[model samples]
Target chain A: MSTPALDATLAPAAGAADAATPGTARARTTAGLRGWAVRLGSLAVVVALWQWLTATDARVGLRFDRLPSPTEVAAEFGRQLGTGVYYLDLAQSMIRILTGFALAAVAGIALGVLVARSRWIGDLLLPPIEVVRPIPAIALVPIAILVFPTDEQGIVFITFAAAFFPIMVSTRHAVRALPTLWEDAVRTMGGGRAHVLWNVVLPGTLPGVFGGLSVGMGVAWICVISAEMISGEFGVGYRTWHAYTVVDYPAVLVGMASIGVLGWVTSASIELLGRRLTRWLPRGEGSAR
Target chain B: MSAPAAEAARVDAGLAIRLEGVSLGYGPHAVLDDLNLDIAPGEILVIVGPSGSGKSTVLRAIAGLLTPRAGRVLAEGVPVTGPSPDRAMVFQDDALLPWRTVRRNVELPLRIRGVPKRERRTAAESWIARVGLAGCEDRLPRELSGGMRQRVQLARSLAGTPRAVLMDEPFGALDAQTRGEMQRLLLDVLRDTLATVVFVTHDVDEALLLADRVVVLGRGGIGCVLSVPDPRTPDIDRAGLRARIIEEL
Candidate 1:
C-alpha cells in the first residue's frame, strides 16, 4: 500500500522505458526456463551433497554414522510407494493437514476481523488470544489430549493451534494497515460500510492474507507431524518413529522425505493460488520468491 | 409533502452544496474554523491556500468524509451526516485499488450503486475512453504513469455522474504539461454534465485556470473569494488575477 513518493516520481520514467522494450514470447519463455533451471539446479546440488556425505560415511564430531545412505533410503522409498500402509499413512497425514488448516483459516480470519474492527471485541478477545497464542503447539499436546475425546481430534487440534496464530496476527495487522483513503474513496462514491468491507478491506488485505496462509500451511505440517509422532498410530510421522524404534533407518529417512515433499507441495499450492488471486498487482524484480 | 418527495425537491434546487460555520480539529489542534461557503449546481469552485490552510479539510467536509465540530455541511440542501453516492472524491494519491484493473477501478462507483454488470462495463469503458485511457483498461494502477493514474481517478469520479465532485490536490504530483492537459480535459468533461465541482489545490495558477470562483483560504476560513467572469473567455487580466491571488495567499 505504501508505494513510496519517490516511486511516483521514478515509476513513470521506468515504465516508459519498459514500454519501448519489446516483450517477445520467445524472451519470456527463455526467462521462465532459466528460472526453472535455477530451482532444479539448487535441488540437484543438495541431493548430490547428501549422496556424497552418505557414501563417504561422513562423521560429524561423534555420530553421523547412523544416517542411512542415499541408495538405502531410495530403495526404502520405492518399497514404501508399493505398499498400502505407506499410502494410507500419507493420506491420513494429508487429510489432517487439510482439515486442520481449513478450520484454522476460517476461525483465524473471522476472529481477526472481529478483533480488528470492534474495540470491544479487541478488548475482550485479543487479550485471551494473545496469552494463549504464546503457548506453542507442542506445549499444548497434554492439554489437547485431555480435552479432545479422540487422538485424531487431539492431533487436529494441535495442527489448528499451530496454524491459527500466524493467520490471525497477520490478518489483524493487514486489516489495521489498510490505507484510510481507500475507505474514504469508497464512502465518497456512495458505498456503504458493507461495500467498503467487501470491495476495499477484503481485497486490500489479500496480499497480506495470502502471505499468512502460505506460512500457516507450512506451520500446520510441522505441528501435525510432531503431534502424530508423539501420540498417533497412523501418519508419516508415526510410521517414521515406528521405523526408528524397529531399527529401520532407511524407512525413517523415507518417511522424513515424504513429509518434506508434502509440506513443499502444500506451500507451493498456496503460493500459486496467491499469484492467481493477485495477478493484477505489478510484479517487482526479486518478488518471485 | 411526503419525506421522499420533499427530499427530491431539495435535490432539484440550484444549490448543490453548502458549508456553514464548519469547524474541525484533531484533539487540540484546529484545522478549519467557522468556514462558510455555498457552491451552486454546475459551478467549478476551486480552493487555493498555503499548507495548513485546511483546503483539503473543506473538501472532506463537503464530501461528508468529515463531520465538522461546530457547524453543518449540506449536500443537495440536506444536512450531510455521512458519505453519500451523490458525492465523489479524487484523492491526492489517486487511491485506485491495486488489485483491480483500470476498467474495474473506474467501475467501482457504479458497482457500489448496484448498477448491473453490462451497464457498468459500458459506462466504465466510455469513461476510460473519455479520459484517453482506452487501451490501458486491463492494466493495473502501478503500471500507469502518475499522470495517467490521475486521469483514471478523474474518469472514476466523473463516471458515477456524481452531483458534486470533490478533488483534493489531484494533480499536485503531475508534471506541469500533464497538469494543463488534465485541466482542459476536466473542463471539457464538465461542460457536458451538470456536475458541481469543488477542486482544492495549492497551485494558484491551476486554481485560476479552472475555477469559476477561486477561494483564497487562510488559517481560519476564506480570506477572499475571487470570481473569474468566465474561464474560457480572456476578458479578465490573467496576470493581475494571479498577482492578486498570490498576495491573498
Candidate 2:
C-alpha cells in the first residue's frame, strides 16, 4: 500500500526522466498481481487438502459426521443462495451488527472524551469500566434476557456490550496520546475550550477510535453468534445452531462460512470509512484498504 | 523604578507591551525570575539565550500561554489575562493544521475573527504569495518541506495582522541553508510590514541578522539590550553584526 502511493507520487517526476521506462512500472504492477495470486492459490490448496482428508478413512469421529467436506459445504451454500434464505440471514445479521456498532461508537467516543478530559469523571467512572471490560459479553446474555422483555433487545445489548469497551478504551488512549503541544497550539491561537475539543482533540483521536471499532466489530460477531445460539430465532448463528441439532453438517459449515464472509465484508467497510474520515493523517495509506 | 513613573512613561510612549517583575515556574522549579521589559510600537526585539535559559517562557508569558506568578503583562495598556487575537504567535514546529491546505491554514485566524469568506480568501491568497507559497496554496502541510511549512506558518502569523507577533525559534527546525533563507525572508517581510515582533532564538547570528534590538537573556533578567545601529537599510555588514553579538554573548 505504501509502495503504491509512493510510486504514484514519484510517477510524474519519474515519467519526465524517461518516458520509455515501461519496465519499472510493469515490474511493480506484476509483483502486486503475483502477490494476490499466491494468496488465492494457498487458499485453494487448503480446501483441496480438506477434501482429500474427508474422502479418506482418516475422517473419523468429529470429522466423520460433525464436519462436512468442502464440496458438501459448497453445494449446501449454493442451495441456500438459490432459496434466498442466505441473503435474508446476511441482511438480518448486518442490521443487528450495524445498529449495535453505531450506538457503541457514538456513546463510546463521547464518554471516552469526557473521561480523558475531566479528572473528576475519569476517577469516578474508570474503575467500573475496567472491571466490566474483563467479563465476556456472552456471559451477560442470561442477565440481558432477564432484564429486557424481548429477545432482539437482549441480543442487541449483548452486541453493544461486546463492542463498547474496545471503542471506549481506544478513544481514551487516543485522547491521552495527543501531544500537549497540540492543545497549547490551539490555545495560543485564541481558540476556546470548545474549539480546541471540537477541532484538535476530536480529529487527533479518530485513528485510535477506528482501531478500537475494528476490534469491537470482531467481538460483536462472536457475541452476536453466541447470543443467537442461546436465544435467537433468526440470524446466521441461529441457523447454524439449528443445523447442528438436526445433524446437517453441510448446512452448519455453510452457516459458518457465511458468518466469516459477512464479518470480513462489514469490517472492511468500516475500515474504508475510517480511512476516508482520517484522510489527513500522515500514516493514512496503510489503513486505506 | 516606581509604579507611577513606569505607568507615566508607558502612557507617554504608547507602549505595546510591558512586562513588570514577571516570574514563572513549574511546581518547585523557577524558570524565570523578576524580569522587566518594555516593547514599544514598531520595535523588533529578539531574545537570545542558550538551552533552558527561559527564553521560551518569556515568549509564552507574552502570548498569555503561561501566567507569570509575580508580575503583570500589559498589551496596549490593557492587562493580558489570556490569549487574544491582538498578539499572534508562530511556534517552532510550524503548527499548521496538517489537514488544512496552506491557504486554509493561513486563513484560520481571519475565519475565527468572522471575516467574510471572499475577503478572507483574497487576504489569504495575498499572504500565501507574500511568503512564496503562491503555487502551493492547495497543498497540505505534510506535502511541504520543512522550510515551506515554516513559511506557511509565517504567512499565517502575518495574515492575522496582529498588533504584535511572538515567534518562538520559528526557524530552529530547518536545515542550515533553509534556516538562513528563512531568516532573510523573515527580515524582508518584517521590514515591509513594520510589525512589532518578539522573536526568540538561541542562534547569535540570527539575532544579529534580524533584530533592531537584541536582548541577551542571562540567568533570569535581561543581561543587555544592544541596539542595532542601521537595520532599516537593505545592505548590512554581516560580519560586523556577528562580531558585536558574539561580544555581547
Candidate 3:
C-alpha cells in the first residue's frame, strides 16, 4: 500500500482511504456493509428454519406446524400486492397514524415547554397529566370508542394517546436538563424571557424532544394496530384480524409482514430525522463497532 | 488609601459600578453581609477567593442574574434590576450555544439588542477574526477544542461592546498552557474595549496578572483590597503583593 498520493492527486477518495489506513473511513464503510450482510443472512436463516418446521409439520415445543409456511405467505403477499383493497388498507392505516402522530407532537411540545418553564403552569397542569400518564394508551381504547362517533376516530384517538406521553415526558426532561449558565448568558445580554425561550430553550431542547418523538412514534404504531384490531373497519390490523377468523393463515401472515415492514420504515425515518436534527452531537467513539 | 479610589482615579468610556451594602445569601446560608465595594469605570478588578467564598456570587449580583437580599448593585449610575446589554457575562463553561455556529453565538448579543442584521454580522465576524478563529466561524461549539471555545466565548463577551464585562472564572476550565494563551489574548483584546471588567478567579497569579485592583473575599466578607502599581507589567516586584494576597486568603 505504498501507492499513496496526496488529496491533490484527485484519485477517488474511497480508494485512497482504503490504501492509506486499514481502520479509517473506507474500513468503516466495509464494516457497515458486512453488518448489513450479517443481518440479512440471519433473517434468511430464520425464514428457512420456519419453512422447514412448517413443511415437515414438526410437533416441536411450539405449534409451528399450524402456521402458514414461508412460501404460502409469500404467495399470499404477492396476491395482496395486486389488489386495490390491500393498497386502500395500507393507505388508510398510514393516514390515521400520521394524523394522530402530528397532532400529538404539536400538543406535546407546547405543553411540555410550558410545564418545564413556569412553576405555576407545572403545578396547574402536572397533576392531571401525571395521573393519566400511568395508564397505558391501549387501555384508553374503551374510552376512545364511547367518545368518538366513528371507529376511525376512535382508533386515531388511541394512536394519539399512545404517542402523546412519551413526547411530553421527554421534552419536559430535556428542558429541565438545560444548564442554568446558558440562561444566565442570555439574560446578561439584555434578553428578556421571550428571548431566552426563543434562542436558548427552543434549540437546546431539540435533541431531547427528538428522543421523545422517536419513542412516541414506536408506541403509536403498537397501539394504533391494537385499536384497529379492536375497532377498525378498513385498516391492515382489521383486515388481518378478519383473515384470522376465517382461518386464512397465509393472509394473516401477509398482514403481519406488511405491519412489520411499515413499522420498520416509519421507525427508521424517525431515527434518521433525529440524527439529522442533532448533527451537532458528538457521534461517540467506535460507533461502527 | 482605598484601592477602588486609586483604581477609579483614571476612568473613561466605561461603566462605574458601586455595590452599596450588598448582602447576599440563600436564606440561612449567609454568604456576604453588608458588603460595600466600589469598582471604578475602566478598571480591571479581580475578585479572588476559595471555593464557597461567594466570589462568583458577587459577579452574579453585578450581572443581575441573582438578586441581593440586602442593598443595591448600581451600574453606570443606575440600579441593576436585571441583566442588561451594558453588563455582559462570560461563564467558565463554554456557554456558547451548542446548536449555533461560532459566528452565530457571537452575533447573539447584537441580535438580542435589536441591532440591524448587517451590522450584527460585521461586528460578529470582526470579533471572530480578532480571536484568531478566522476560518472556523461556521463550526459548532462541540467541534472546537476547550481553548478555542473559550476564545469564542471571550469574543462573544467583548462583542456588542458592553460597558462592563462580568466574567465568572471564564478561563477556569482551560489547561495551564491554554490558560496562559487566553490571559495574553484577554489582555490584547482588553486594550480595544474600555469595559469595566469584574473578573473572578481563585488563582493568585491570575488576580495580579490582570487586575488594576484585587479584592480578596472570604466566607465572612471581603478580606482586603490591593492596588497594583502597574498591572500586567512583568518586570514589577509582585512577590510581596502575591505573598500578601496568599496570606489574606
Q: Against the true structure, whose lDDT is highest?
A: 3
List the pairs of residues colliding in candidate 3.
none
Question: Which lDDT tens digits does candidate 3 get at residues A1-289?
Answer: 1112222222455455667685786666777578768978999999999999999998878887798999999999999999999999999999999999999999999899999998999999999999999999999988987999998899889999899999999989999999888888899889998999999998889999998998999999899889889988899999999999999999998999899888878877887677666777766532211
True contacts kept of each: 0.98, 0.49, 0.87
Kindly list the per-residue Cα lDDT of model 2 for residues B85-200, writing each as its tens digit: 76888999948887678888888888777789999999999999988888999897877899999999898888877768899999999999999899888887886664578999
Candidate 1 chain A, poorest ten consecutive residues by summed lDDT: A1-10
Q: Is candidate 1 or candidate 2 better by TM-score?
A: 2
lDDT of 1 at A42: 95
Q: Provide the lowest-lDDT 10-residue window in model 2 chain A.
A: A1-10
For candidate 3, the docking band is medium
i-RMS for every candidate (Å) is 1.2, 1.5, 0.9
The CA lDDT at A210 in model 3 is 93
DockQ values for all predictions? 0.72, 0.53, 0.72
Error of 2 at A63 (Å): 3.4
Q: In candidate 1, which residue ranges exceed 4 Å CA deviation?
A: A1-60, A285-289, B1-15, B234-236
Model 2 residue A112 lDDT? Answer: 92
TM-score of each: 0.89, 0.90, 0.91
Q: Write the per-residue lDDT of candidate 1 for residues A119-195, one digit (tens) a residue.
A: 99999998889899889887999999999999999999999999999998888999999889888998999888798
